[model samples]
Target: MGVEERRQQLIGVALELFSARSPDEVSIDEIAAAAGISRPLVYHYFPGKQSLYEAALRRAAEELATRFVEPREGPLGARLLRVMKRFFDFVDEHGPGFSALMRGGPAVGSTTTNAMIDDVRQAAYEQIMSHLDIAEPPVRLTLVVRSWVSLAEATALLWLDGREIPRAELELQLVHDFAALCAVSAAYDDGMAAVVVRILEQEPLEGPFGELVGRLMAIAPTVMEQVVADDRTA
Candidate 1:
């Protein structure tokens, strides 16, 4: 293989090892041995185990972000549904790498790695909240957006853990769950205008005041139903 190709091969091998075991658990020597190269050759590409681990994670995150975040122009709900499915599909194919990212099981420093995860999270949150029709510059709206993003992250991690779930079924469940959250968020937005007017004497709420609060409140019941339904199925 060429230099770049060999480097990627090393990365691919390193990811398998990293996913199968902890970062500290596997040594550079082991990776070199598995890649059928001298330890010095491995060093040529990655300085150490930590470097390889981070490289693998970056590759995985970039692939996932590209698949999930690119190609817009659809309804927000449709886009999210597609993204969610793509996420699960990626995890299904790269279970160990997905596990490391989703669970944070690897020992890689957050400085380099967490940034990518955070970027994707923020992008997803922005896309989701943008779809809502809410009064801008409102407190309730901000809260709703925060709450929905938090809920999506938590639930998605849970889905990652339940690797036994059939891909089709998992996607279906996510769609239903996300739809319910959006509905509740919308309901909350509808009621929030009145709620805000009622509490007008209080501090001013800002940014999609109605829709934000709606999305946030909507996440709670959806969470409850998810737990209950999951329990029943379990």
Candidate 2:
């Protein structure tokens, strides 16, 4: 293979190894052996194990960021649900690697590694903002989107530990969580309210957001009755 091709092949090999186990556990010798090359040849392509690990991480980060890209032709809730599905798909496939990267296992505190993770988050933020189609989003709106992104990351990390909750259910709940965040924000901010209005205008009753509304509506009377009873007791 040519230089670039060899580098890419090594990266691919490293990523596969990294995905299966922590980068810290995988050594240069293993990478070289996996690539069917000598350790010196591996060094010729990269400076050290750290550089190779970063290259593999960069590749992983790029792929993770792309998972958030969805075509803008569906209801906002559906689009987000699809995005969540893809995000979890990556997590499912790269369980150990995702855990290590997010939890700061290998190359922890490394500026480049942190920046690549931030780049992925920023990419997700931009994708969400584009989906929201907000030219100048209010602070609350931006907060909601960024917080949801973080929440998704945290959720994935927790889910990886035991995976007790069903992945499909978690994916759906994340979509509902986004809607809930927006609704709560809308209650306090007029700008968010308007955004929510615009979003609901495009959502169908069968969509995720609408289903959330329906579920809340279904229990509203009971909740109100309990409130009334508590008020009377008071």
TM-score to native of every candidate shown: 0.64, 0.96
**What would the per-residue lDDT of candidate 2 be over residues 136-215, giving only the tens digit for each residue?**
89999989999999999999999999999999999999999998999999998899999999999999999999999999
RMSD vs true structure, all candidates: 9.8, 1.3
C-alpha displacement of 190 in model 2, angstroms? 1.3
Candidate 2: global Cα-lDDT?
0.91
* Clash count (model 1, backbone only): 15
Distance from true position, residue 15, model 2, in Å?
1.3
Which one is best on lDDT?
2
Candidate 2 Cα errors over 4 Å, as ranges = none
In model 2, the Cα lDDT at residue 165 comes to 98
